[model samples]
Target: MHLFSRFQFRDWLLANDPALSRLRMASRVTLTILLVFLILLAIEAFILPLPTAAFGLGIVLSIEGGVAVRDKGNARQLVTRLFGCAVSLVVVAIAAGLEDQRVLSDLVFLVIILLASAGRVFGPRGFAIGMFAFTSYFMGAYFQPPLAELPEVAIGPVVSVLVGHMVRAVLLPDDWRRDLLRSLESVSGRINQILFKLAALAASGDIGEADRQELRQLEDRLKEVVLMAETFIPRPSAGVFDGASNPAAELAIRLFDAHLAAESAIVLSFQSPPPFALVHAVIGADAAELKRYEGMIEASKDQPQGETVRALLWLGEARRQLTEAINRGGACGFSGVDAAKDTAQAQAIDFSLANPLLRSALQITLASAIAMGFGLLLSRERWFWAVLASFLVFTNTNSRGDTAMKALSRSLGTVFGIAMGLVLATLISGEPDIAIPVMAICIFLAFYFLQVSYATMTFFISIVLCLVYGMTGVLTLDLLKLRIGETVIGAAAGTAVAFVVFPARTRGALDAALARWFQALRELLGAIGEGKSGFELIALSQKIDACYRDVTVAARPLGSSWSVVTRPGQIRQTLAIFLSCTYWARVLARSYEAPPADDDQRRLITADLALVDDAASRGSACFFIKRKASRTAGRHLPVSREGARVGLEMVGSALERLYPQADTLPFASGEAIARSKQG
Candidate 1:
C-alpha cells in the first residue's frame, strides 16, 4: 500500500500497470509540456509569425508519441507513432474541407465518427489513432482557415508531434529499453537472493509461511516480468535497434527464458520440505556446480542423486544461463536464437468483416448519421460538437451497458468541464499577462491526466479550450452552453443506438469469459491427470490470467443491469469457488504428484478427477444459463495421499457446491423487462 511502491502503483492504474513506470510517464509528459510552453513563449517574444495556439496541437501529438517509446524498440515504435500522426493529419485536413458546406459538413462529421469508432475493431493502437483522428477533426474544423492558408495551418500541428517527442527524448534520455533491462536486472538479482534464501532454508530443514509467501510472490512477479518482456522485445532480425546491430534482442529473450526455467525450479524446490542432510549435500553440490558453470548453464550429463539436489541443479543451470546472457555483449558468443522462436512474433492485423464488428460498425455509423442530421437541423456550427460527442461515446463500447457508462461519463464530464471553463474564462477575462502561464498549467494537466481519470482529463480539456478561445477572441458563455447542449444530444443519440441496435448484456460477456476459463481449467486438469511436467503449467496460468482480465473488464459495466441479474454477492461467490479450485489445481499440477502403485489405482483416480473437471465445466455453464446440472458426474472421490487424488478432492469441493445453485438465478433481462413494464 506504499504510494510509491512500483508494484502497488501498477495495481492503481485503471488498466493494470506498474506504478513508478506511469508516474515517470506523467513526469515526462509534464516536462515536455513545460518545454513546449517555453519554446512558444520565446517564439512569441521574437514576434514569430507562426500561430502559437496552433502549435499546441502539434506539441501534444509529438509528446503523445513519447508515451509509447521503449528500450531497444526505437525504430518500429517511432514508425507507429508517426503513422498515427500522419493518419490524424489527413483526417483533420479532410474535416477542414468539409467545414464550408452546411449539409455536407454534417454528413462528413457523422462519417468521421463512424470510421473512428469502428477503428476499435483493430485493437488499442488503432483505437488511439481513431480517437486522435476524430478529435483532430474537431480541432481542424474549429480552426478552419481559408483554402489558401489551410496547408500552412496544417504544418504546425504536423510538426508539433515531432517537437513533443524531441523534447521527451532530450528530457528523458534513458529510454524504455534501458529502463526495462534495469527492471529485469533488478528482478534477476532478487531471484538470486531468493534462491540463496531457499538454499539456506533447505539447509536448516525448515520453511515458514513467510518464506513460502515470498517464493510465491517472486513466482508471480517473474510471470509478470516475462509477459512484460515479451511485449517490448522486437523479433529476430526485426532490427528494433539500429539495423544489423540488434545487440540486446537475443539477450532479452534469454533473460525471459532463463527466468522462466529458474522460476519453475524455485517453485519445485519449495513444494516439499527436504531433510537437513539432503539440503546440506545440495549446498555443497550447488557450490561445486557453480564453480564449474564458467558463466554458462551447460546442460550437464551428470545426474544429481536426490530430488532436492536435482531442483537445485536446475536452478544453478538457469542462473548460469541468465548470467551468460546478461554478460554477453554485442554479437557475442551466446546465441539467444532459441529464445526468439519461443516469443510469438507479431502478425499482420486483420479485422475481418465479421459480426459484432460489422454490427458495431453499422450501429455507430447509423447512429452518428442520425445525430448529425439532428444537430444540423438545430445549428450547423454546433453540429460538430454533437458528432464529436457521438464519436467519443461509442468509440470502444462493447455492450449497451458500456455505451451507457461512457455516455453518462462523457456528458457529465463535459458539463462539469464547461462550468469550470466558464469560471476560468471569467477570471482571466482581462488578464492577458497571466493567461499564457495559466494556459501552460492547464496544458500540462490535460496531458498528465490523459489516462488516469477520464472525468478529470475532460475538465482540464475544457479549461484548455476556454483559454485558447480567449486568446482567439472567441470565448463566450453562450457558446459554452451551446457545446453542453450539443454534447447532451449526442450522448442521448449514442446511448439510444447502443441499447436499440445491439443490446448486449454484461452478464452474457461474463458468462463467455467464464466459459473460456472453464475450458482452460479442463485442459489443465487433464494435463495434471496425465502427469505433464509442471514447467508447462505456465502456459495454463497465462490462459487463466487472460480470462480473469476479461472478467474484470466485463464486470466494470455490469452496474447498468446487475440488479436484474442474480443477488449482489452470488456471482462473486461463484467466482471465488472457481478461483480457489483453479489455484489448487495449479498447485497440484506443479507438485511432483507421485503416480499410483497400480494401473487400477491410476485409472480409478483419473476417472474421479475427470468427473470433477466435467462437473466444474458443466456447472459453470449451467450457472450462467440458469439451468440445473443434468448429469450428476462426481461421487465421493476415493481419499488418497497420492497428489492427484488429493488434488481432485480439493477441486471437487467447489464444483459440488456450485451444481446445487446452478438453477437458482435467471437471466436479468427477463426480470428487468418485467420491472420496467410495471414501472
Candidate 2:
C-alpha cells in the first residue's frame, strides 16, 4: 500500500511538471553523444580528443535551443546547427591566432564577449549562436590549441551537429500536433485530479493544513500543465479570419477557462462553514463532465478538422458548466480573500531589450575583464572559470536585483558544489567505473533541474567538473578551493558592475511591469466596451495575461524570496491586487461574448463599461506617470447587468485591498459596486 501511494505521488509530480518533456530531451542529448561515440568505435574511426568531444557535446546540447526549434523543418534545423558549428570554429580560430600575444588576446576576447552577448538582438537562434561563440572562445583560451590543430578540432563539432540533426529529424522527430494533444490531455487529467481531491475534501468536511498545501501544489501543477499546453499549441495562423475564428485560439481559451474553473473551485473549497454538500456535488459533477470532455478530446486527436472544433466546443461547455456551478454555490459570497493564493510565474527572459542587450553586453564584458584579472592571480589555468561565471550572471537578467540574486545563487551553488565535489572526489578518486556513471547522473540531473532551479543545476554541473578532474588524475583540494574563490570573485564583480553601471532597480522594473499590466488591462477593457468578442478580444486577453505574468516575475525580488521587502504586507497586497485584477479582467473578457439582449441592457453595460474603462485608463496613467491616482472613494457606478455589476464589485474590492489603511488615492472608486436587480 505504501509503495502504491509512493508511485501515485510520483506520477502526480510528473503530471504537474514538464519533467517528462525535459527528461526526454536530456535523454536524447545524452544518447546522441553515446551513439556517436559508439558508431565511431564500431567503425574504428579516429576518436575526437577530449577538448573536441566537449565542444561537440556543447553544440549538440544548445544548437536548436531545446524544444523551441523542434517544430522547424529539417533544413532549418540543420542550418541552425551548422550556424552554431561555424560560429564556434571561427571563434576558436580567432582565439588561436591571438594566443601568442597575451595583451592583445585578452582585449580581443572581451570584444568577442560583447558581440556574443549582444547577438541576442536576433532572437533565440542568435542567443544559441552567441552561447556557442562564447564557449568556443573560452575553450580556445583555456586549451591554447595550435592553429595547425584547428582543422582536427573542427571535426568534433561537425560530427556532433550532424548526429544531433539525425536524432532530431529521424530518430525522434517532434510531431507538434501530437505533442499539443498530449499537453491538452495532461491539463485535463490534472484538473480532474484536483477536482477529485476537492470533492473528497468537501465530502469529508475537513480542510486541514496538509490538505491546503496539497491543494496549492495541485493548483501549481495544473498551472504548469496549462502553460505547457499553451506553448505546445501553435498560435492562430495569420489570415482573413479573426482570432476567435481560429480553432487553435479557441482551444487555448478553453485551457485557460478550465484553469480558472479549477482555481475557483479550490477557493470555494476553502471557504469557512462552506456549502460542503453543494461543493461536493458540484465538484463531483465537474469531474465527470471534465472526464467526458477529455474522452472526446482524445478521440478528436486522431480525427479530421471538424472533430477538433466539436471537441473544443465540448471543452468550453464543460468549463462553463463548472464555472456556473461555482457561481451558484456562492462564489462571490466568499469575499475572495483566500482566492489570491500565490501563483508561480514562469521565468521571464528580457528578450524585448533591443538596446538593453547591448548595454548588458558592455556590462558583462567589463565584469568579465575584472574577473579575469583577479582570477589569474588565483590560478592562471582556471581564470576562464571566473570569466564564465561573470558572463553568465548577466544572462537573462533585467534588473540589478536580478543580477545580484543570480550572482548570489551562483556563489552559493559553487560553495555547495565545492563541498560535495571534495567529498565525492575523495571517495571515488580511483574508480572510473563508478566515477563515469556518477558523472552521467550529474549531467542528467543538471538538465532535469536546469529550468527548475539554477542552483541545483549548477551543483550537478560542479559535481561533473569535479569527477572529470578526478578521472584526469588532477583532483586536489587546492584546485577545488581555487574554484570557489574564483567563482565568488566573478560573482561579486558581476553584481558590482550591475549596481554601478546603468543600474536597473527591481522596484523600477516592478513598477514598469505593473504599468504594462494595467495598460493591457485597459486595452482589454476597451475591447469589452466596444463589444469586440472574436480574435481581437482573445488577442487582448492574451496580452493581459502576459503582462500579469511579467508583473508576477518582476515582483519576485520584493517578495519573501530575497528578504528585500520592507513591508511584507504591502507586497502581499500588491500581488493580491495583481491576481484579483487579472482574474476579474479575464472573467469580464470571456463572459462578454454576446451582444446585450436589448437596448436597456446594452445601455447599462455600456455605461458600466465606460466607468471601468475610464478607471483602467486612470490606473494606467497613475502607474505610468508614478503619481498618486485621483481618489473616488465614495462614488458609484450603478449597474443592471450581472457581469457589469460583478466587475464593478471587483474593482471596489481591489481598491479596498490597495488602500486599506488611510484615505489614499486608488486605481478606482471603492464604492462603485452598486448592484441592482436586472431591469
Candidate 3:
C-alpha cells in the first residue's frame, strides 16, 4: 500500500508538469469515467435490475460518445440522441410482432437500415433514417421477446443516459452565462491592448516592424475569439434544457463591431502615416484616457453604475478613433467622424445563397430514399433495413470530409469490436459464474475509452454486445459475421448515396465567395475615399473577414472544381493590391495637416488625393465587372500603369485590369497626368 501510494504521488506530479499537462487532461477524463462507472454499478446493484442498468448505461454512453470527438453543438447532440433512441425503440416494438416470419422480417429490417443510411448522406435530412435502422436490427434479431419485454430492455439504457447527461452538465466548471460575459470582457480587453500599442507606436513616432507584426497577430486573434463566442450562443431551436438565451448577445455583437472599427483605424493609420509631433501628443493623451476608461468599466462591474459604464464604453470607442488618427499621422485628428454608418451595406454583400438547412434536408432525403430502394431490391423488409440505413445516413451531414473520417473509423472500430466479442464469447462460454462480473468489466472499459478513439470504442461496444448475447446463450460466430457485414453494407451505401445525389458543388460556392470578395474590396475602397471612420470602417473590416472565411470554407470542398473557379485566386491577389493602395491613400490623408502653400507640398497633396480617387474608382469598376463576369461569359480586362509614379499608378493599373471596360474606366487622362507630376 505504501509503495502504491508513493507511485501514485510520483505519477500525479509528472502529470501536472507543464510539459505533460495535456496528457493530464486525458488522464483526468479517464479517471472521471471510472468513477462514474463505479457509481453506476452501485446504483444497478441497489436501485435497479442489472439489465435495466445496462440499457441505461448504453444510452448514457451513446449520448456522451461524440462530444469529445467532434464539436457538434450540445443542442444538436441532445436532439439527435433523443430522436435516435425513440426511433430505435419504436422499430424494436414493430419487429417483435413479426417474429413468426423471422426470415422475412430480417430481410425487411436490412432494407430499412440501408434506406436510412442513404438518407443521411446529404446532411441533416437523413437523421431520422439512421435512427430507425439501428432500432430495427437490435429489436428484430437480438431482443426477440414479447412487446411487454421491449420497454424493459430500453428502460435501463434511458435511465443511465439521463443520469450521465445530468452529471456532465453539473460537472461543467463554467455556465454559458459566465462564459459569454468573459468573452465580452476579453474582447474589450483586447481593444484596450490594441489602442495602447498604437498609442505607444505613435508616441515613439516610429512604427517598428515588430510592432506592425504584433498588431496584425492581435487583430487575427480578436477575430478568432469573436467567432468562437458566436458559436457558444445557443440556437433558438434548441429546446428547454438548452443553454439559456444570452441577454448580452446584442452587446457582444456591438463589441465585435467596435473591435472591427478599431482594426480599420489601425490599418488606415499604417496607410496614411500621421505627422510626428501631433501623433506623439495625441497618443500620450489617448493612452491616459483609455486607462481611466478601462478602470471605470471594471469598477462598474462591481458597483453597477449604468451611466458610468456607458460613459467608459463611449470613451473607449473614442480612443479607438484617436488611436487610428495618430497611427495615420493624425490625418483625420479628433474630428468626430461617424464610423457606424456602413455596417448595413457591408452585411448586404453576401454572394452565396446556399443555406445550410436546405443543403442538410436535401442530403438526408436523397440518402434515405436510395438506401430504402436498395434494401427492397435485396428482398428485405422495408422498415427494418430502413432503420439500419438511417444510422449510416446521419453519420455524415453534407461534410464529405467528416463523412469519410466517420466511415473509416466506424469500419475499423467495428472490425476490432467483432474480434473482441468473439474472443470474449469463447472465454465466458462455460463459465456462467464469471459472466456478470466479466460483462461489468467490459462495460467499464468500453465507456472509459470511448473518447480515446472511434475504432477502440467501437471494439469495446462490440465486446459488450457479444457478452450480452453470449450471456443469453444465443451468441454465435455466424451472427458476429452477419453484424459486421451489415455495418459495411450500410457505410458503403451511405457514402455512395452522398456522392451521387445533389452533390455539393465546391466550385459554385467558390465563385460566389469570389464575387463577395470583389464587392467587399469595392466597399472598403469607397469608404476610404469618403473618409469613413468609426463604426462604418469597422463594419467594413468585419465584412471583409466574413467574406474571407466564406471563401476558405467553400474552397475546402473544391476538390476537382478548383480549376473552374479562377475567382478565388484572382480575388486573393486583387485584395492584396487593394489593401496596399488603401494603406498608401491613408498615409496621404494623414500627410494633409494645415493647408500646404509651398509648391512641393501642394503638389504632393494634390497628387495623393488624385491617386486616392483613381484607386477608388478603379476598385469600384472592378467590382461591377466581376459581378458581370459571374453573370455572363466576358473577356478579361487588361490594365496598365499609365502615368503612376510612386507605385500608386501600379495599384490603379491592377484595379483596372480586374475590370477593364471602356465605359467602366474611372480615371480621367488629365487627373492621371496631374497625379503623375506630383509623384
Candidate 4:
C-alpha cells in the first residue's frame, strides 16, 4: 500500500510538473463527481422509489460520462439520452399492453435493440437513434406481464434516472466560463514563451537539433491550449438547467475564434527562417501587447467588448508577424540551418495512421450494447429492461475508444456491488432502517474510488446494487447470486455484440480522416491564393481543426496495448504536418493584403500562389497514395511560373523551393479565372 501510494504520487507529480493546471482540473472533476453522487443518493433514498432510483441513476451516469469525456458535445449527449429513455419506455409500454405473447414481445425487444444498435453504428448521429430504440425496448418489456403492476415497477426506475441526470447537471462544476478564461491566459503565456524562444534562436544563430525538437514540442502544446479555448463553453443559461433558457454563448465562442487566429499566426511566423534579431524585437514589442491584454481582461469585468477587443489586438499582432516574416526573409544574417531542421521535423510528423469514423462507431456501439445487454437480462420487466438498456447504449457515444475502461469498470462495479449487497442483506435482513445509511456510505465510497481505477468503480457499484435490491425485500443470498449472474451475462452479451456486429476498424477510420484533412488543405490553399476575407479563411481553418480533432479521437483507441497493429507515432506525425500547414495558411490569410500593381509584387503573388497549390495537391496525394507508383505519379504534378506578371519577384524564391516540380499545374485555368472574379 505504501509503495502504491508513492507510485501514484510520483505519477501525479510528473503529470503536474511545472504547472498544476491539469492537476487542478482533475481535482475539480473529482469534487464535482462526489457532489453529484451525494445528491443523487439522497434523491434515491428519500424522494424516489427503487425503480425510479434505477432510472435516475442511469441518467446521472450518462450526463457525468458525457462531461468527463473530451471533445464530446454535452448538450447533444443530454438530449440523446433523454430521448432514448423516453422512446424505449413508450415501446415497452406498447408491447406490454398488446399481449403476453413471448414471440411478439421478443420481436419488439429485438427490433428496438437493432434500431438502437444501428444508431450506435452511425457514430454521432446514433444518440437519437439509440435513444428511441432503448425507450421502446424497456417500455415494451415492462408492459408485457402482470399489467396491473407495470406502472409501479416502471415509474421508480424512470424517475430515479431522471433525478440522477438533474443532479449531475445542477451540481457538477461546469465552470466553462472560468475554464475558457484560464485556458486563454495559459495559451497566451505559452505563445509568448515560444516567440521568445524563436527570438533567442534567431539572435544566437545556434539552431541545434535539440532547439528544433523543443520548438516542435512547444508548437504541439500551443495547439492543444488553443484547441481547448476554441471548444470552451460558458456557464449554461438558467433555462438550460431546467431545459428552457437561452444564454448568449456567442461571445464565449468568438473568444475562441480570435485565439485560433492568433495561434495560427504564431505558427506561421515560425515556419521558415526569420531574422533572429527582428523576432527578438517583435518579442520586446509584445510585452506591451501582453500588458494591454491584461488590462483589457481587467476592464472586461463588467463588459464584453473589452474582451473582444483584447482578443482582436492579440490576433492583429500575430497577423503583423506573418506579414513581416513573409516580406523579410533571414535579414538577421542567420544561416538557414534551422530551416533544414524544420523540414526534417515536418517529415517526422506523419498522418497515415489517423482513424476517425471507425473508432467513433466502435466506441459508441460497444458502450451501448454493453449497457443494453445488462438492462435486458437483469430488469424485472422485459420491456422496461429493454428501455433501460437502450438508455445505457448511448451513454458513451461521444467518448473515444469505445470506453473500454468504463465498460470494464461498470461491469466489475456491478459484480462487486451485488456481492456486498448479498452480505448486507443477509446480515441486516431484520433492519431495513439501517440500509439507507449503509447505502449512502457505499455511494460515497464508490465515488471516492471512481477516479482510482476501474475496479474501484465496480466495487462502489456493487454496494449500490445491493442496497437497491435489498430495498425490495427480495434480499436473499441466492437472489444476490442470480442478480450478479444476470449482470455478468449482460456484460458478456454486450461485449460480444460489439465485437461481432459491424466491428469498427481503427485503420479504416484513420484512412478516412486523412482524406478529409487533405480535402480541407486543398480548400484552404484555394481560399488563401484568391485573397479571401478573414472570416471566410477563419471558417476554413476551423474546419481543418475539426478534422484534426477527429483524427486524434480515432487514433486514441489504439492505446498502448494495440501498439503492435497501430503505428501511433506515425499517425501523430501526419497530424502534426497537417496542423503545421493549417497554421501557415492562417498566417498567410491574415498577412494577405490586396496585391500591389507593381510587376514585382504581382509576380511574387503568382509564384507564391502556385507553390501553395502544389503543396496542397502533394499533401492530398500523399494521403491517398497506397503504392510507390501512385505516390511517385502524384508527386509529379506540374509546377510553373508561366504568366509573366510583375510584383512577383519577392515570392519567386520561396515558391520555387515550396514546389520543386516544373511541369503540371494542380488547379485548372478555369478555377483561376473564378478566383480572379472572386478577388
Candidate 5:
C-alpha cells in the first residue's frame, strides 16, 4: 500500500496501536494545530509573542491540542473522542467566565478535578474529559480579563472544536468500519484454511504437534481480538451493502476448537479408520449433508462394541458443528452485551474508587496546584508551564516505576526540545514570517504523534513553545530554567504523593484474580464432563485470560514477584492440568463417547477427575489466601493409559505441594506422624 495513498492509508490508520494507524487523525490534527499557529502569527505579526501565546494557549485547550488524553485499552470512535473534547471545552469557557472571581474560579477548578477523578464510575473516558477540563482551567485563567472578553475567551476553544469537526467531516474520510470488516474477513478465511488442514489430518489418521500448536496460536489471537475489539454494530458496507459486527473470527474460533477436539478423540482412541474421516471426504459439502452425517453418527451410538464407533461418532458430530458454525459466521446478530450484566459492569466502573484513579487524581491535582502556588509566590512570568509540567508528568504516571520512567523520558525530551527550540528561535528571532511557519510545522508534528508517545508530543510542543515565546519577546534563560525546575518539582511531588497515599504496593488483586481463574477452570472441567456446549465455556476462557492480563498489568508497577503469595510455577502447572483436563473432557463429551471402555477405565477416569478437581481448589486456596493444601492417594487410576496416570500424578503432586513451609508447622515430623496415627 502506498503510504500517502488515501485509500491504502486507511487500513494502516485503523490499526490498534497508540497511533491507531489512523491517518485521518494525523491529517486533521496537523491542520488544526497549524491553523492555531498560523492564526496566532498573523494576529501577533507586529505585537509581542507572550500575549498571543496566552490567547493561543486558551484556544488549543481541546484534546486535539496537547491536552494529554490517555488511551486506556479500548477506545471510542474518532468522532466520539472529538465530541468529548468539545464538551470539555465548554467547561473551559465557563472557567474563563469565573476567572475574575478567584474564589469561584478556584472552586470550579477543584470540582473539575473531583469529577475527573471519579474513574471508578466513569472509567477512562470520563477521566479524560474531566482531566481535559481541568488542564484548560489553567489556560482559561491565564487569559482572563473581564466579562467583556468572554467572546474572545470562548472563541479559542469553540473554534478549536469547530475546526476539528470541519476537518474530520469535510476533508478526511473515516475508514475504521471498513478496515475492521476487512480484518475480520481475512482472519476468518485463514482460520477456515487451518480447519481444512485439520480435517485432512483426521481423514488420514494422523496428528502432528506442529498442527496443534498452530491451532493454539489461532486460539490466542482469537481471544486477543475478542477482548480488544470495540463492540459496535457496524454501518452498511461501503456505505451501501449490509454489514454485521465482527463475529466471523469468533465463529471460526469455535470451528477450530471443534476440529481440534475431534483430532484429540481420534488420537486417544487410536482406532482404525478414525472417526469423521468420511466427513472429511466431503469437507466442503453443504449444511444439509453435514446434518445427515450427524444423524448417521447418532444411529451408530446404539450398536454393540460401539467403543471405537464412539470416536468416529464424535468426529462426525464435530464436522456437523463446523458446518453450523461456518454458517453462523457469515451472519452475526448477537446482542454483544446482556442488559443486566452490562449495567452491573457499568455501575462498577462508574462508582468504584479504585486506588489507581483516586490516587492519580489526588496526586496530580495537588502537585499541579502546589506548583502553580509556588509560581504565584515567586511572582514569576510564564508560570503556566510550571503547572503544565506537573500535570503532564502526573497524568502519564501510574506507579513509582512509571513515574520514574516518565520523568526521565520527559526530562530528556524537554532538553532536546529546548535545544532545538533555542536554535530555531535564534534563527528567526526577528522574522515573524519565518518563525510562524516554522512553529506551524512544530505544532502539526506534535499533535500528529500525540497518540504515539507522550515524550514525542512534549518534544515538539517544547519547540512550538520556544518559537511562540520568542515571538512574544519573552524567551529568556531565566524563564527556561524556571520551567525545568518546576517540572522536576512536580515530578518529585507526584511520586511522593503516590507513596504517601492510596499506594498500590501489594499484588493482592492479581493473586485473588488468579484464584478466581482456576476456580472457573474447575467449573469448566465439570461442565465438559456433563456434555455441556455453549457460551459458558467461552466466557470461562475469557475470564482466565482476563486474570492473566490483570497479573501482567499489576506486575508492571511493582516490577517484581516478591509480593505473590503462592509458588508461581505451581499455579502455572495447575493451569496446564486445566487445559489437558478440558481437552480430554471435551473428547469424552462427543456423541460416540463410551464409558471409558470398561469398568476399571471408568473408575480411573472418575478418580483422576476427582483428584484434579481437588487439586484445582487447593491451588486456588493457596494462591489467594496462602492456605495449605494436601494431596490424597489416588487408588483407582489404572496403569493402562500412561498419559492418564502421569497427568493424574502431576495434579496430585501439585496439590500436595501447596502446604506451608516446615518452619510454619509446630510439631516435628516424628510427632506429626504419631498424632496422625493416634487420630
Candidate 6:
C-alpha cells in the first residue's frame, strides 16, 4: 500500500482538529509561564528569599486554576479566582501545620483528594477551586515549608493570579462571538471554494478515485468546522446573543445545512457525472445570480434545464440562504423561533456513593493510597509521583475500560519517554543553557497537543521532568528507571482499583449512551412533527451530537478486537447502525421546513413518526436488556408534500433499517425477553 493511503493523513487531519481555542490558550499559558519565570528570576537573584521550585509550581498551578474557572464577566472571574486563592492559602497553612504529623497529614491529604475530586460535580468554578486546593496541599507536602516561609510561598500564587488575569484579559483577550462569526465567515469561503471545485469536477465528466478521496476529505473538513463552531455556541460569553434570536447560532445552523447541501451535490454529481454543458450552464447561472444580488452584473437570461439540475439546485438555494443571512445581519431569523435560552444547567453536588464522581473519587483515593505505599518502598522522595500518576489515570475516564486504556497509554508513553530522555540528557550533558530552552519547548508542545493526544502529552511531560532533573544535577540511569517503575506501579494500581472497586463496565456505559441518543432523537423527531421553532431544533440537534460523542467513547472498547465482550463484532455492527441513524437525524433536522398542508397527510406523517419513535424505544430497550431488536413496523414514511416529506422519508428509512441488523446481534430475541417478562 502507498504510504499516504496507509496513514490517511488527510482524514486524520480533518478528524483531530487543533481547534483555535486550544491553540490560543496554550500560547497564553506558555507566555504566562515565561514571563512569570523571568520576573521571579529577577526577584530571586537580587532581592528577598524565594524558593525556585516552590514558586514555579505554585505559579503554574495558580495560573491553571484561574484559567480553568469559567465565568461570563471579568469581574466575576476575578472574584472566583481570588476565592480559590483564599481556599488554597488556607489549605497550604493547614498542610504546613500538619507537616510534622505523618499519619495526620496522610489522612488530611486523602480527605482533600476525595473532596477535590468530588467538587468537580459542581461545575467549572468548583473544579477550579478543587484544583487549587489539591495543588496547594501537594506543594506544601513537597516543600515541607515551615510557618515562617508561608508568606513567601503565598506571594507566588498572588502574583500568578494577577499576571494570568492580565494575560487573559488584556494581552491576549478573546471575544467568542467575534471569533465564532469570523470562523463562520471562513467556513463560508471554504464552502464556496468546495462548490467551485465540485462544479469543475462535474464539468470534467470523469471523477477518479483521487477526486473522490479529496471530496471525502472536504466533507470531513466541513463537518469538523461545524463541530468547532458548536463548541463556541455553549460558552457563557455567547450570552451576547441571548434574547436577540441568537443570530450567530442561526448562522451556524444555516452554514451547516449549506454544507450538507454542498456535500449531497458532490456525492450525487460524482456518482453519475452530469453533462459537461449543463454543469457549465448551471455554474454560469449561479455566478450571474450572485453578481445580480451584488448589483455588479445583470441577471442571466439562459436557464439550466435537466433532472441533474435538481441535485445542484439545493446547493444554489443553500448558498442564497447563507448569503442573504450574512448580508442582512441575520434579519431573516427563524420567524417564530424565540431566541435560544442558555442551555447551561447547574449540577448540584452529588454526595451519594453511587454517583460516578463519588465513585471515581473513591477509586482514585484507593489507587493513590496503594501506589503511595508501593511507591515509598521504591523511592521515598518520589513517592508522590506515583500517587499523582494514579490520580491522573482517572482524570477523564467514565468506565473501567477507559481507565485501562489511559493507564496503558501512560505506561507506554513513559517507556518511550525514558529512551528519548536518556538520549537528550546525554546530548545536553548538564548544560543548563540548553536544557532550559528545551524544557520550555516541551512544556508548550505538551499543552498544545494536550487535547489532541494523551500519549504524546505524557511523553513530553516525561521529557520535561527528565530535563528538570538534569538541570538539578541529579540525572542518572537509576533515577530514570525508578521513574518508569513508579509509573507502572501507579498505573497498575489505578487499573486494578477501577476493575475491582465499584466498576463501571463499558458495555453498560454503551447501553446508557445509546439510550440517551435514542431519547434525543425521539425528542427531536417529536419537535419536528409539532412544527417547533428552529431554535428548539438546533438545541435538540446539539443534544443528539453530545449523545453521539458519548456513544462513540463508550463503544470504543467494543470496537477493539481485545475487548472482553463475547460478541465484539455484534456490538460493533450495532454501533455502526447507530451512527447511520445519527446521520439521518442530522439530515432530517437540516431538511425540515413545515408539516404537510393536508390534515390527513399530516396525520399520516405523524403516524409514521410515531412508528419512528416506537422503533427507537424498542431498539434502545433491547440494548438495555442485552436482547436482539426485532423487525420494525414499517419500511418508510408515507410520501407527502416535497417540503417535509424528504426529511420524513430519511428518518423513516433510518429507523426501519435499524431493526433487522439489531435483531442479528448475538443475544436472545426481543420476543424472548418480552415472554420472560410476561412470565
Candidate 1 to truth, TM: 0.64
Flag the better candidate by lDDT, 1 or 4. Answer: 1
Q: What is candidate 3's CA lDDT for residue 24? A: 31
Cα deviation in Å at residue 484, candidate 2?
A: 0.9
In model 3, how large is the Cα lDDT of residue 39? 59
* TM-score-superior candidate, 1 or 2: 2
Q: Against the hidden reference, what TM-scores do the models get? A: 0.64, 0.77, 0.46, 0.50, 0.58, 0.78
lDDT string for model 6 (333-399, tens) is 2342333455766666667886888788889889988998898899877777787789889987888
Give the distance in Å from residue 526's predicted Cα in candidate 2 to where it truly belongs.
Answer: 1.3
- Write candidate 4's Cα lDDT for 1-679 as tens digits: 9999997665444322223344443343444444455555675688764344234434443433433323234465456556545654556566656566765655555555555544533444464545445544444354343455455445533543454344445644344544544554555466666667766765675555456556656766666666665555323322111211212233333444444545433333333333453454455665664554555456543333333333334554654553343223224321221111111121232222234334434434454445454555565442233233223432543332353444465566666667766787667766767976676666555554543454675676677666766776655676666555655555554445445555544555555665686566557545655655344555566666777667665655555242233222443434444554455444444344444233433344554555545554553233332211100011110111121121122123222323334323332232232344347
Give the number of colliding residue pairs in candidate 5. 11
Per-residue CA lDDT of model 5 for 137-227, tens digit only, reads: 6666665645555545544555565555555556654444443444343333333444455566666665454444454444434334433
What is the C-alpha local distance difference test score of each model? 0.56, 0.63, 0.47, 0.47, 0.49, 0.66
lDDT of 3 by residue, 272-294 (tens): 33333333333355566555555
Model 2 lDDT per residue over 515-573, tens place: 68767766765666566765566557666667767776776765444223322244544
lDDT at position 569, candidate 5: 38
Which lDDT tens digits does candidate 1 get at residues 263-304?
545544554443444334333445654454423323521222
How many backbone collisions does model 2 have? 2
Better by lDDT, candidate 5 or 2: 2
In order of lDDT, best first, we have 6, 2, 1, 5, 3, 4
Query: Which wins on lDDT, candidate 4 or candidate 6?
Result: 6
Q: Rank candidates, TM-score, best first.
A: 6, 2, 1, 5, 4, 3
Indicate the residue-level lDDT of 176 in model 4: 50
TM-score of candidate 4 to 2 decimals:
0.50
lDDT winner: 6
